[model samples]
Target: MNFNREDMNIVIVGHVDHGKSTIIGRLLADTNSLPEGKLEQVKERCRRNSKPFEYAFLLDALKDEQEQGITIDAARCFFKTEKRDYIIIDAPGHIEFLKNMVTGASRAEVALLVIDAEEGIKENSKRHGYLLSMLGIKNVVVLINKMDLVNYDEKVFENITKEYTEFLNKIDVEPKCFIPVSGFFGENIVDPSNKMSWYKGQSVLEVLDSFEKEKLPDDKPFRMPVQAVYKFTRDGDNRRIVAGTIETGRVKVGDEVIFYPSGKKSTVKSIEVFNGEARESIGSGYAAGFTLNEQIYIKRGEMAAISGDIKPKVTNRIKVNLFWLGRSPMVKEKEYILKVGTSKVEVKIEEITKVIDASNLNNEVKQQIDRHEVAECILKTDKPIAFDLSHEIAQTSRFVIVDKYEIAGGGIILKELEDEENKAHKENYKWEKSYITLEERAEKFGQKPALICITGKENTRKKAIARALERKLFSDGRRVYFLGINNTLYAEDHNKKEHIKRLSEVSNIMMDSGSILIATASELNRDDIETMEAAVNSKEVIKVWVGENEISEIDEDLFVSKEDTVELAVDKIKSLLQKKNIIFKPF
Candidate 1:
């Protein structure tokens, strides 16, 4: 049967042996949703095996599940009510398969948590409840199954409801309703049950139909994690396209867009389609592609968002609520891989704020996160990544952790933290401002402010060229200054890296006064240049290498040979600055 986008995803989760599969099978059978004669085929197979037929057998398609009487993976079954269609995900309830459970539940818009009335609340039941909360599923219905075994006792149902309700509340989950069901007897599943008149509520089918379809995030800001950047040179057609499924809102041709983590800006030139008429705009859920007005360096991992909307946070440090499922416990200072959206980066647990006992709501201070334990912790990535908070946009907020190339944990970002690099930028922005703005200063000085970094190996005459350039510019009625790296050497407990950082900050401050600040540092590699670029205006940082050989992978604006005298080298550098418009050339 064809299903539309309004179809809802509902996940069934509970402890092992909690009749989760049985409930789904009964729902399908009672509603006449099973395939033609598939029910009879299963029944006949049971008879041939000399076994009594169970509703759970209809869904236990795998031989291992039938043998062990437990699900090992998430199974999807489609059913329809008159209101809308549903994709019921039967998530495995075994604790060992909790990761599988997460995978299933993550796709669901609503959840139905099952608990065996005879067995009462199991550890897995509460654990699943906590996971439902963490997974951002707000709509939940608790199903107390096997009420027939308890003789449909109202007292037993009420007691289980009260206890589980209290437990769910601790995790900030308020279940929509509590249902007592007997999949074996088909009571209160599709039809009202005469066996229990004490209960007054809709049946499972009615409850499901009552649920409104989860509204698409079309009203939010446009966000699309670039899945791929395609270049089709076939038949001499040259078009660089950015392609991905929109996670929220819409994008149209001519809209200004910005990519985060790199902060590149561009305009949507045209929308591309396959064998269809070109569209003017596209919204969430469309796997779309577009050409840009300008060629900017955008990779697969960056978030392309509308420039005017709420921007996604870009940072290397973040706080998260995560659960561990690895064989080895998650320890502090150990490296792992964090995958969010299309971006995957090396990550590490900075600190475990606390480990939570999901079954009982107990908190403990721990150095490591054990299997099946939930925790709130700080995570540090090797580089900046773009994402939203869980409260803001959950689609971009969710992440998974891979340990040893295997998925070991999943979580949502609580918030982004200000790392040292970000803090430095923030501090730089708050520096004292003069009444004369930088623009005014630039107009008076007739030169745009810039940081010219002269870098090369030790004993390469970098300082001499920097000083000579400063002298020439000052003599030519220009604002210029030369600072050496060693000036900040003895500043209170600063290391080599910290010294470089200080030099960058000073350059930033000096550049704010509309002066061409020329600085020299020995053996400056790509990283050092990047650090200085981050602290100052990246576009204004002109890198000049004064050596015979290249050291690292640095993008140098000018390369001077050791044989070239300092004066000619200075003249070449000056000509470059004039070409770049950093300084005005003589008329």
Candidate 2:
């Protein structure tokens, strides 16, 4: 679609009741961009609801929102000024409507942060500002709205502006312009206000029109996040096309391009837009399709860009700053659905390095992130996905975490998985040596107690103890199998079996190995523990309880303790081995 000479995409955002919708409505009415009967229809609806005719009602269309007298979703309104055509997105200011704000702001190049002159900077106002920074929106114009409510007082405007400026400075966002206006009174929005003659500044529209679009980074590498794939069969042509809006740089025909993660390379055959193939090259801001010379597997959501200058990395773990909005607390064990651009994958919160106290933005690592809290966390996905740092590339860096089908949090990746191959190799080697040495010793000793399951209330503490025990057992020249719950072998093929059968299988494997299996299970009920005990056979089983819970009424000696150290637990197990008369040479 062709735009006017000064066409720009601008999003209006602020706290709810900050007059975002009214500003848009007044701009449309003043510019004569409203459709013929649209205003009349809005008026009729307002009357039926016993509400005063609000210009905001012209844009907010959701029935629930209109009934509640609040905007719950982002509303898009297109209008034109004498100078430029604008696609103005009116985003909700309510804190719960943050995801809607992100959706709207992600599309716009410029943002108008509307703050109330009467209320100053509220929570949602600061939150919107922080989110804008996270989204990489630098071109911001802070509108100090409700000048009429503040009696168009210059002092009120100045005070609020000063306070907001301080807050913005703390967050590293410097507003390009600060304009005082009244959306309800239609003052200083489309035209200059005579009442604010002391404030010799340009009108809102004038400032927007005068503001220059931030220059594209000259040093930025080519990045195209694949949005969709097109297969055109028009009479004769049967071509496969990959299409997306370029996030940065430029790509030309015959440029060597690479698909991420898969690392498949191909030459760009042609750059095709809606108006057929373009003779020149296509740059950022244009949605275009490219046909590759060879058929390489390029899927939707995969990034395709110039190969040599920049390459996307496949990473399993990432350190990111997350804003948790889920009703449920974000726990480490539970998995969350993550979406970066079009790529979606299930990821677990591996480690919450720090939970930022949103009230003061303090780093609190040990504290659990509750609803509406922002946290710096480490996440590990089930598979390797392409990613970049937010500072390096905003498009690939930002992501949203979803829980129970609702967007819970949004974040930016701070660091990608580093030294992953080396870590993987070390882990593999450890597991291999443990398994090999245990099997060899088992064969020699004729299948002794190979597995030692450590029952506990906390899985993390249990794993830590299990690791320490593995070292101790291996040093004592005994085969030790330290099986973590995350083991893929046990996770797979356990779906079809009954609950009892699954436990039995795990126990049978531990026994067959003839090596002590030190593992932990959380929330182990009496029945489950009994099933596990029976599976391993009471004669060969040694139970270590971490909490005050009776194992079973069976004939097996149990060691129960509330001690929190791994060393103490290891000593108890060592004493038990001595009591059993299992003699072995220490390494």
Task: Give lDDT tens digits, candidate 2, residues 396-451.
Answer: 67778888998888878889875363354334324333345544755686336634
Give Cα-based local distance difference scores for all models. 0.83, 0.70
lDDT of 1 by residue, 304-413 (tens): 99988999999899999998878899998889999888888899989899999877879999999998899999999977899999899888888888898888888889
- Tell me the lDDT of model 2 at 286: 67
Candidate 2 positional error at 535, Å: 34
**Model 2: which ten-residue window has the lowest total lDDT?**
550-559
Off by over 4 Å in 2: 1-4, 40-51, 61-77, 93-106, 215-219, 230-238, 278-280, 419-422, 426-587
Question: TM-scores for all candidates?
Answer: 0.77, 0.67
Q: Candidate 2 has which clashing residue pairs, if any? A: 450-514, 450-515, 450-516, 451-515, 451-516, 451-517, 452-516, 452-517
